[model samples]
Target: MPEQYLKKILTSRVYDVARETALVRAPSLSRRTGHTVWLKREDEQDVFSFKIRGAYNKMAQLDADTLARGVVAASAGNHAQGVAMAAQRLKCQATIFMPVTTPAIKVSAVRNRAARVRLVGDSFDETLAAAQVFCEKNAQ
Candidate 1:
């Protein structure tokens, strides 16, 4: 990629994901599983998770035309907040779909990211389907 594009990628919304998240070697877990087990301590993320990386990367890679149309995604957990925050930083409209069963805390976090939040179905699968339909209809 060109320097400009590389810069965009490096400084993309995903960049906001803290690199400080730990990579802890877990000998106990490794022994239990009978294999090497290194925990990617995403639990330490600013939002207390790692799903934000994909969310930011995906949104940041959008072409100018796609961004003009906005973006939508379905997620019940960490992913929802990631997408919301990334969209907010990119100054693009974002719509998030989550199951009605999602915890209030997660819902509040997504809202904090400034994305339009919709509590749709009873399960993640149903929520995802609804979000996909919505995205397709909106050409997102």
Candidate 2:
């Protein structure tokens, strides 16, 4: 997509929200490895990760009718939180799936975003399968 046209389609407020994220220089890692290293400081985000940026960006593009129908997504960590936050901000229902072994931190992160969290299967693949089934059944 053309960058300028794409920018116009997205709401300015959402972009503002994402812009608060920091881009931290990786001084220690760079020095240790003798390589250029930098970290996109998504950890400073409102939800404490980069997920919000992509999630909000995607949800912000959905039409009203589709938003009313809600959205479903499967993710293990950061992406899940991002999707959940985006859905909540858009006032669209969100269903998220995480593997059974996902750390509590990740699960809590999504829950804190007000996104419904479901623990299923053992690996990302299995969790994704369950999420797909749920989405199909829910008609999301």
Candidate 3:
């Protein structure tokens, strides 16, 4: 598993969609703790989360045929937006399945990224199952 992660990190193409976030010192926190502290500004990303890096990297690694078959993910938060944005950038179709209880704003965000957003079950487990079924039926 460690070796697989190392290979993925070395081959990642995240920079195609994500910039290198800055690490800035936290002056107040450092002063209070009497130790140097730094903050990775992942929130500054286009998706406002580091999930974009992993999402883009995974898509980037896919072959042309796989990409053509499309991508699907189950998420309601930042991961949804990340996968949507990555699919748009790669010119691949993406289906994002979110729990029915997810807020409209999150769904809107994923849709804005040009992904097909589906409101599935009311919980994460249910949503995941729905996505899996979709993938199996679509051969994605």
* Model 1 TM-score, all chains together: 0.79
The reply for model 3, stretches above 4 Å from the true place, is 1-11, 32-34
Which candidate comes out best when scored by TM-score? 3
Pairs of residues clashing in candidate 2: 51-82
Of 2 and 3, the candidate ranking higher by lDDT = 3
Q: Give the Cα-based TM-score of candidate 3 against the true structure.
A: 0.89
Best by lDDT: 3
lDDT of each: 0.83, 0.82, 0.93
Cα lDDT tens digits for candidate 3, 1-140: 69998997667799788988999999999999999999999999998999999999989999999999899999978999999999999999999999999999899999999999999898999999999999889888
Report the lDDT tens digits of candidate 1 across residue range 67-138: 778888888879888778778878888888999999999999989988889999999899999999997787
Could you estimate the TM-score for every candidate?
Answer: 0.79, 0.80, 0.89
lDDT (0-100) at residue 7 of candidate 1? Answer: 88
- Candidate 2 TM-score, C-alpha based: 0.80
Off by over 4 Å in 2: 1-16, 33-36
Residue 25 alpha-carbon offset, candidate 1, angstroms: 2.3
Tens-digit lDDT string for candidate 2 (29-106): 999999988888767777777667778877888899999988888888888988887887788888889998999998
